[model samples]
Structure formats: C-alpha cells, structure tokens
Target chain A: MYLEIKDLTVLYDRAMVLNGVSLTVGKGEFVSLVGPNGAGKTTLLRAIAGLVKWEKDTLKGTRAGRITLEGSVKFDGEEVTNLPAHEIVRRGLILCPERGRPFREMTVLDNLRAGAFGCKDKKVVKENLERVYHLFPRLKERENQISGTLSGGERFMLTIGRAMMSQPKLFMIDEPSVGLAPKVKEDLFARVKEIYEQGSTILMTEQDVSFAFDLAGRNYVISKGHLVGEGTAEDLLADESLRKTYLGL
Target chain B: MVEAILINGLVLGGMYAILAVGFALVFGVAKILNMAHTAFYMVGAFLILIMTIMLGFPSLPSIVLAIAIMGITGSVIYKLFLDRVKEHPVAVMIISVGVAILFQEVLLIGFGGHFRGIDPFVRGFVEIAGIRATYQQVIAIATSLVALVAIRLLLSKTRVGNAIRAVAEDREIANVMGIDVSRMCVITMGISAVLATVAGAVVAPIFMVHPLMWMHPLTIVLAAVVLGGLGSIKGSILGAFILGFAETAVVFLVPMGAFLRGAVGLSVMVVVLLLRPEGLFGVVFEEERL
Candidate 1:
C-alpha cells in the first residue's frame, strides 16, 4: 500500500468521531468511502490529511473543545500521523475540502495561483496553470472573475482545479457532488474520471452511492465512526445488508 | 488659508493612512487587535531622538535603524506572545494592551514625561500652492504614497503576497495548500511594525514626541479602522484620510477646534457606524474579512 492507516481514532472531547478505524490505498488506485451524513467519512479523511491534528494544536489553550487523535498514518512508507497539515501537503497529500471553499474575495486565477504556492519554479507553475486551464476551460475564461461569485458547479471545478495545481500524489476529495444540480454533478464526475484516468490516486468520500460506485475501483462502507464493509462495487452490492442499510441502495 | 488647510490635511491624512494600514494588516492577517501598534510608533520617534541626539549618530541612519529594530521586535512579539494566545481573541487584545502600556512606562522611566524633539531628515520648507510646508511634511506625503503603492504591489504581484492574502482569507485552506500560516502571521507583524515605525519616524519632527503620544494616535487609529470597516486595507486608508480631513476642517472652521479634533473625528465614526454597522468597506461575512 502507498498509503496505510491503522487504528485511527479521533475524539473531540468525549465524542468519538472515528473509532479505531483503519484503511489503505495503493499507488494510483481510485477508492471511495460511501456513507450517510455524520458517518465519520469526513473525519477519516481529515485525520489522514492532518487537519484534525491541526485543529487540536490550534485549539489547545482555548475554550474551543479539545480534540484527541490517536492513530498511525503512513504515506509513501513515511510516518505522517504527527506531521502538520502544511507538511502533509508538502509531501503531496492534499485535500479538497467540502463546499469548494474558494478564497471568496480573490480572483479565480489568483485562487489557482495560491493553490500552486508550494511550487517555487515559475516554469512548472505556468505549466500547471496551463494544464488546469486545459482541464477546465471554463476556469480559463473566468480567470479574472472573483471566485465568490462563481456558481456551485464552477466553484467545485475551481476547487478541484486548485487541488490539481498542487501536483498531488494522493487527492482526497470530500463530498464533491453535494448541493450541486444533477447536470453539474455529472460534469464534475466526468472531470474526476479524467483526473483518475490521467494516473492520479484518489480517495473520495461521497453521499451519492451510485456516483461513488460508478467511478471508484474499490469502495468502503462506513456508518457512525466505523468501516462496516470494504470490497469492489459488485461484491458490496451483492451483500444485502450493506446495500440496504449502509449504502441505502 | 485654503492651501494651509489642504496641505495640513493631506500631511495628517497621509500619516494616519500609513499608521492605520499597519494596524489593519495585523488585524487582517493575525486577527489581532494589536493595541501595541502605535506604541511602536512612539518607540520609533524616541529611537531617532536617542540615536541622533544622545548617541550622535546621523539622523537618516538613526531612522533606518529604528525602523529595522521595530520590524524585528514586531516579529518577535508575534512569535513569543501573540502566536500562543491567538486562538483567544480577548487574551490577544489584553496582552497587546499590556505591551503598549509597558512600552509607555519604560519610556517614561528612561526619558521622563517631558516632550522631546528630533531634527528632521530634510531641513527647510517648500511652498506648495502658496502654502509654506516643512520638508518633513513633503517627505511624509511622499513616503506614505510610496509605501502604500509598494504594499499594494507586494500583495497583488508577488507569490509571497498571494500566500499572505491566502492565509488572511482562509488559514486552514492556506495550510492545506502548503503555505505556513504561522510564518505568514509573523511576517505580517513585521511588515506592520515597519509601517508604523516609518510613520513615527517621518512625523517625529512635525509633532513633539513623548511617552504619552501613543495614546492619542491609538484612539484616532481605532476610530479610522472602525469607520473604514475593520480589516480592509483600502478601507483603513480611506477611513484615515476622512478623519484626517474632518479633523483638519474642524480646526480651520471652529473655535477651539484643535482641542475638539478627536471628538469630531470619532463622531464621524459613530455616525457612520449607526448608518452602516459594518463600515464603508467591511464585509458582512466574517470569513470574507481581509
């Protein structure tokens, strides 16, 4: 496995957001974690990306509730469980957070440029910008427009495009289809598919079960802080309990 | 008389714009209500006095050294104190207030409460539109415009500036993009300190320097920042100029207006706040503030 996890448990004060959950993803594999709202899928991704640890460190002395995280996350055979979020990103693990949180006041192009902040070489950055523009031509057209004014689907594209600018080895996308119209969702699905086909590893969490199943090579079913099942789409669908109870299929 | 009012207003507004921009940047980037900000201005003025008068260093080098020292002091303050308490807003503000008072008292003990003066970098006066203005005033205007334009370029045209803006806008998202948020905050503090110090150094000859001089600027700067909408750089500059002109206009038009200047400026703030609670350029959404 390129990315390995073991016994990852996260506690926000007394609430067990993720309880002794473990998972893995091999290089260049497309894996999806499908679960309903509050099922700990987001928590799992956040823990892996080091954001939960960041929250814990930042909220240490404040009245903000405490977060206790315990686990081992190894990316590319290196321990990343204790690394800061920026360090995790520097090592090529990136998260496109939910709602496509564009830097609302900045231009679309500036947002993309910000995404490429870590890369120092101007040539490489320019190439990445062109590549992103090629992938989503709409971004190129609206490059000067403020990102806050972008529509739901365009924001999602911008988020993904921004993530692409980072040259990630593993992309963790959280709920890309949420709050988007079906047509927009279809367009995003095609973009994600193109990204994966171009040889990128992806671990995605989705509420839309069929959407996840349609694109992901493998799947994990999570419910209330635990991974209930894991298999290929056909294997999980054939399991009557997982499909009906967890997948809501 | 009109030229005198216009020149004085421009000079005062330019100084206020420089001061408020620094204050606004610290607040925007670090979310710190840094009460110690104008204290840096006081320190800068005094530093020039000590170096030029006591140590016998040249005036220009003294000013440059003072600005540099304040920049480092600002960075160290953020790293040593502000960074730890940043998650707690009230704690940050209280600590900053404590810092400001500490600077004032230390200066009072070392130099006494009597007002002091420093020689201007450029001596003599220039006639601008039939009004005689000191060369120091011209320098202040030029420096303010130059500093603001440079800062604008830095924020808009450079990679580090983009990262700074990114951190200011959304810290978590910036962290996820591999931009070090703490480092950005520290750098912003340093920049803010430099700006305040420059404002102090340039205007030291025009205004008498004293340990208590920091208090008046703090009151007016807070008003300007609030009136222009907090955390918006352009708004702060705009707000500063408005108050500067308003106070200058009062001084020209009303009897005892010099004494009534601060009250008039703050009244503008109050009226503006009553009409638009967010100020002229303030964003309604907390997340959108910069």
Candidate 2:
C-alpha cells in the first residue's frame, strides 16, 4: 500500500467525529470516500493531512473543544501521524481543503506560487506553473485577477490548480464540488479525471455519490464516523443496505 | 509659522508611521494586539543609550546591535509566551500588557525615573522647502521613507513576503500549502520589533527617553491603528500621518495646545470611527479582514 490508515479515531471534547476508521490506497490508484454530511469523511481526510493535530495544538485553550486524535497514518511507508501539516506537505502529501479557499486577498498567480512554496528549484516551479496552466487554461487567463473575486467554479479550479503546483504523491481533496453549478461541476469532474489519468494517486471525500462513483476506481461508504462498506462501485452498489442508508441511491 | 507647522507635522507623521506600522504588522499577521510593542521601542532607546553612552560603543554599531537584540527578543516573546495564548485574544492582550508593565518597572528600577537623552546621530540644520530643520529630523524622515519602501518591496516582491501575506490572509490554508504559519508569525514579530526599535533608536536623540514615555506613544499608536482600521498597514500609515498632522495643527492653533495634542489626535480618530467604522483602506467585512 502506498498509503495506509489503521484504527483512526478523532474526538472533539468527547464528541466522536471519527471512530476506528481504516482505509488504504495503492500507488496510482484513485479512491473516493462517499458519505452524508457529518459522516466524518472530512475529518478522516484532515487526520491524514495532519490538520486535526494542528487544530489540537493551536487551539488548545480557546473556545474550541479539546481534540483527541489516535491512530497510525503511514505514507510512503513512513508514519506521519505526528508530523505537522507543512512537514507532511514536505513529504508530498498535499490536502486541497474544501470551499476553494484560494488565499482570497492574493492574485491568482500568487496563490499558485504559494502552492509551490516548498519546492526551491525555480525551474521546477515554472514547470509546475506551466502544467497547472495547461490543466486549467482559465487560471492562466485570470492570472492577474484577485482570487476572492473569481466565480465559484473558477475558485474551485484555482484551488485544484494551486494543489497541482505542490507535486503531490497522494492528493487529498475534500468536497470539491460543493456549492458549484452543475455545468461548472462537470468541468471540474473532467479535470479531476484528467489529473488522475496523468498517473497521480488520489483520495477524495465527497457528498455527491454519482460524481464519486463515476470517477473513482474504488469506493468506501462511511456513516457516523465508521467505515460502513468498501469495494468497487458495482460491489458496493449491489449491497441494498449501503445503497439505501449510506449512499442514498 | 505655517512652514514650521508643515515641517513639524511632516516630521512627526513620519515618526508615527514607523511606530504604527510595526504595531499594525503584528496585529495583521498574528492577530495579536501586542501591548508590549511600544515597550520594545523604549527598550531599543535604552539599549542605544547603554551601548553608546555607558559602554562607549560607536553610534552606528550600537543602533544595529540594539535592533538585532530587539528582533530576537520579539521572536522569543512570541514563541514562548504569545504563541501559547494566541487563540484567546483577551488573554493575549492581558499578557502583553503585563509584559509592557514589567518592562516599565524594570527600566524604572535600573535607571531611576529621571529622563535621559542620547547624542543625535547627526548634528546641524539643513534648509528644505524654505524651512530650516535639524539633521536629526531629516534623518528620521529619511529613515521612515526607506523603511516603508523596503517593507513594501519585501511584501510585494519576495517569496517570503508572499508567504507572509498568504499566512495573514488564511493561516490554515497557508499551512496546508506547505508554509509554516508559526515560523511566519515569528518572522513577522521579529520584523515588527525591528521597525519599532529603529523608530526608537532614531528618535532617542530628539525625544527625552524615560520609563513612562512608552505609555503616551502607546496611546497614540493605538489611536492611529484604530483610526486607520486595525490590521491594515497602509491604513495605519495613513492614520498615523493624519493624526500626526492633526496633533501638530492643534499644537500650533490652540491656546496651550501642546498639552491638548494627544486629545486632538484621539478625537480625530473617534470622529473617523464614527463616520467610517472600518477605517480607510480597511476591509469592510469582518470575515475578510487581514
């Protein structure tokens, strides 16, 4: 396995967000986690990306409740559960957070440049910039525009493009299609497929079932912080309870 | 008389700009209302005094040494104290205020309560725009301009500068992008301290240095920062100059106006807040503020 998570659990002041959830993805594989709202899908991704630990460390005494995270996350055969988010990114595990947060005050170009912050080679950054531009021509066209002013779909595209600048080993995207028009969502879906076909390992959590089932090679169904079902789309869909209760299909 | 006011106001505004920019930078980047900021300014002046007058070091090296020490102090303070309580704004403010008072008391005990002064880095007067000003005032203005321009370039043109801005815009997202948010905050605090120390070092010759001097300037910086809208660097600079000119104008126009200068500056800030709550150049929405 290129990425393995075992017995992962997270708690916010005793409210269990994720409970003993485990999953895996092989190199160059595309995996999707499909679940309803508050199903711990996002939390699972955040734990893998080390953001849950970040919140736990930074917001220790504030109004935010105490967070307890447990489990092992091994990436590229190294345990990364204790690493900081930036350190995790240094190892090529990049998380494109939900909501298309494109560093709102920055220009489209600067946001992409920031995405390549860890890579010191100027030539590599330039090459990544060209690749991102090739992947999303809209970003190149609006390179000078402030990201906050971009349309919802454009913002999502910019978010994904920004992530591509980092040269990810395992790209984790959380809820990319949220709050997007169907046409814009379709464009993003196609772009994601192209990114996967270009030989990248991907793990995405999404609420849109059809969107997830169509693109991902393997799928996992999660509900109330537990892994309810896992298999290929056909095998999972064949189960009636998972389809009716978890998938809402 | 008008020329004197214009020249004096410009000089005062330049000093205030340097002072308020540091305060605003920390607030903008770390969301910290560091009450100890002006205290660090006072410490800078005292360090210069100790190095040049007491230890007999050259003026230039003393200034450089003072700034370096303050920068390290700023970074340490953030890492050790502020970083732990950053999430609670009220706690952060209280702790910073305690730090300021601690500095004041330490200075009072060490140097006594009397005012002291340092020799100006430069002497003599120069005529500019039909007005005569001391070389010290000229240095202050020149230093302010250079610092502001350098800071502008650093923020807009460099990779580290872009990362700082990104951290300021959204810290969590910046972290996910592989930028170390804590390191950025520490660097910002160091820069903020360096700016304040430079202001203190340059102005120590013109202004009397005392333990209590920080209080008045802290109030003025608070007024400037609030008037300009908190966390906007350009707004803080503009607010500082506006208040600087307002205070200078009051000193020239009002009867016994020298004592009323602080009041006039604060009243201007209040009026501006009443009219435009966000302050000039400040983000209007709460969520979008830098």
Candidate 3:
C-alpha cells in the first residue's frame, strides 16, 4: 500500500471524531470519502495533515489504530504526529484545506510562491511555477490580483493552483464543491478529474455524493466518525439500500 | 511660532516613531503587547551610558554594542518566556508586565536610581527657522528617517518581511505555506529589540537615563500604538507625532507645563480612541470570543 491508515481514532477536545477508522490508498489512485454532515471526513484528513490538536486527547494505545505512510513513516521515520503543519508540506504531502482559505491580503503570485517555500532548489521552484501556470492559466493572468478580491469559484481555482505549486505526491482537498454554484461545481469536478488523470493521487472528502461518485474510483460512506459502508463507484451507485441507509442517497 | 513647534515636534516625534514602531511590529505580528519593550530601550540607554561614560568608548561603537546586546536579550526573552505565552494571550500580558517590573528593579538595584547623561553623539547645532537644533538632534532625525525607510524596504522587498506579514495577517495559513512560524516570531522580537535599543541610545544623551526613564517611554509607546491602530507601522508614526506635538505644544503654551503634560497626552488618545476604536489607521483586530 502506498498509504495506509489502520484503525485511526481521532478526538476533538472530548468528542470522538474518528473511532478506529482504517483505510488505504494506492499510488496515483483517486479516492473520495462521502459522508453526511458532522461525519468526521474532514477531521480524518486534518489528522493526516497533523493539524488536529492531539495534546488534550487520551489514546487507547492500540497498535491497529496507527497511521503509517510507506515512504518515510517507517519506524525510523520522523514522528510527524508532533511536528507542525509546515513540516507536513515540506514532506510533499500537501493539503488544500476546506473553506478555500488563501492568504487574503497577499497577491495571487505571492500565494503561489509561498507554496514553493519548502523547496530549496531554485530550478525546481521555477519549473513548479511554470507547471502550475500551465495547469491553471486563470491564475497566471490574475497573478498580481489580491486573493481576497477573488470570487468564490476563482478562489477555488487559486487554492488548487497554490497547492499544485507545492509539487505534492498526493493532493488532499476537502469539500471543493461546498459553496460553489451547481455549474461551477460541475466544472471544478471536471478540473479535479483532469488533475487525477495527469498523475497525482487524490484523497478528497465531500458531502455531495452524486458528484463525488462521478469523480471517485472508490467510495466510502462515513457516519458520525465511523466508516459505515464502502465499495467501488459502480457498486455504490447500483446499491440503493446502502445509499439510503448510510449515505441517504 | 508653530513652525518651531512643528519642526521640533517632527524631529523628536520621528525618534518616538522608531520606538513605537518596534512595539507595533512585535504586537502586530505576534499579538503580544510586550510591556518590557520599553525596558529594552532602557537597557540600550544604559548600555550606551556605560560604554561612553565608564568605558570611554566612542559614540558610534557604543550605539552598535547597545543594539546588539538588546537584540540578544530580546531573543532570549522570546525563547525563555514568550514562546510559552503564545497560546494564553492574557498570561503573556501578565508575564510581560512582570518582566517589565523585574527589569526596572534590576536597573534600580544596579544603577542606584541615579540620573546619568552622556555627551551628544554629534557636536554643534544648526538654526532651522530660528529654532536652534543641535547636530545630535539632526543625526537622530536623519538616522530615524533612514531606519524607517529601511524597515519599509525590508517589509516590502525581502522574503523574511513577506513571511512576517503573512504570519501577522494569519498564522495558520502561513504554516500551510511552509513558513517556520515560531522562527519568524523570534526574529520579529529580536528585530524589535534592536529597534528599541537604537532609539534608546540615540535619545539617551538628550533625556537623562535613570532607572525610571522607561516609565515615560512605555506610556507614550503604548498610547502611540493604540492611537495609530494595533499592528500598523504607518499608524504608529502618525500617532507618535500627534501625541509628541500635542504634548510639546501644551507644555510650551501652558503655565503649569509639567503637571498638565500627562493630562493632555491622555486626553488626546481618549478622544481619538472614542472617535475610532479600530484606530485612526482603520486597522481592526478580530476579537476571539469564547
């Protein structure tokens, strides 16, 4: 497995957000997690990115409930659980968090430059910038514009473009279609699908099940922080009973 | 005439501008109102006093030494105390007040509360619109203007400056951008320390250095930051002059000058704050609600 999350239990303050949740993703595979409101899909992604506060929680000390990434999360690997959010980005595991939270006052180009801050090689940075511009020409045009002035849909594109500047191995996006219009959401989904086809593994969470199923190869349904149902896209789309019961399809 | 008052006010106000800018930079970027920032100025004054008076060091070298010492001290404070206070803002404020008190006491114990003065950093005076200005004052004014310009350049041109602004605007987003947030914060504190020290050393000869000298600067710096708007460098400069000139004018014009100085300064800030709570610069800090 390229990435393996084995029985990961996450708690926010005193509330349990993920209870012994386990999942896996292969190299270059696009996986989408579909769930109802307050289902802990976002929490799971945040925990993986090391943004979730862990100091106040109590752990059960179960070996099965462990997050192990193959590349450097080996026994000798850096214990990223205690490291800050920036270190995770430096490791090429970038996350475009929910809410399209770009640096509001900074120009679009500055925001993109910030993404490449982890890379020391100037050549790599230049190449990355060029590639990001190629991927999203809109960003290239609006490079000097302040991020705060962008529309919701344009901000979404800039957010994805900013993440692309980091040159990550896997892209973890949360709720891309959250506040977008229907047609814009459709267009965004198409862009995300195109990104996946261009050779990057994706781990995304969404409340929009119909659109999520269209883009995702495999789907998992979560409820109140637990994985209740999971299957291939065809299996999930065909099964009416699973959708209504777990996902409210 | 008001011309003399305005020129003198601007000159002195520019120096205070430096002092308040240091305070604003740390507060804006880290959201920690370090009460001991004034103490760093005091330390700089004393360092220069000791170097030039006791050790017989030259003025320029003494200023450089004072800035370095203060910068190191500020970094140490950040590492030893301020880092722990980053989460609990109230605790940080309390601890900073405690640190300020500690610094004042240390100075009192060592220096025995005696007022000390050194010769001006530069010699001679020039008549500007019939107001005789000393070469030291001219040097102070020029140095301050140059420093402020340099700071503006650093903030707009350098990578570190952008990182600082990013952290100032939103720390979590800066973290996502792979900025070492803690490191940047420490740098900010250190730079503030250097700024405070330089301001102290430059003005120490003009205003006699005593154990209690920081009390006045501390009051004025805070008032300037609040009046200018929290987290704004430009606001600090504007506020510093407004307060500096207002106080000087009242003092020059009034009969009981010394007694009414504090009253005038406080009233100006109160009036400005009442009109604009976000500050004259229109900078607003989002208050986190529990």
TM-score per candidate, chains pooled: 0.97, 0.96, 0.90
Model 3: lDDT of residue A188:
89
The superposed Cα distance between candidate 1 and the true structure at residue B76, in angstroms, equals: 0.2
Error of 1 at A210 (Å): 0.8
> What does the lDDT come to for candidate 2?
0.90
Candidate 1 ranges with C-alpha deviation above 4 Å? B286-290
Least lDDT summed over 10 consecutive residues: which range in candidate 2 chain A? A56-65
Best by DockQ: 1
lDDT of 2 by residue, A1-249 (tens): 999999999999979999999999999999999999999988998899999999999898765849999999999999999999999999999999878688887899999999999988999999999999999899999999998899989999999999989999899999999988899889899999999999899999999999999999999999999999999999999999889998889
Ranking by TM-score: 1, 2, 3
Better of 1 and 3 by lDDT: 1
Per-candidate chain B TM: 0.96, 0.96, 0.94
Tens digits of per-residue lDDT, candidate 1, B120-171, equal 7788999866788888888888988998898899999999899999988998
CAPRI-style class, candidate 2? high
Model with the higher lDDT, candidate 2 or 3: 2
The digit string of per-residue lDDT tens for model 1 on A127-235 reads: 9999999999999999999999999899999999999898899999999998989998999999999999999999999999999999999999988899999999999
lDDT for model 1 comes to 0.91
How would you class the docking of model 1? high
Mind giving the per-residue lDDT tens digits that candidate 3 earns over A1-249?
666676777755456778888887778888999998899898788777765532221111323223332211211134455566778777767788887788777898878777777776879889988987887788889989998888888898888988887888878899999988999998889899989999999988998988888888887888898887788878876778876776666
Candidate 3 clash figure, as a count: 0
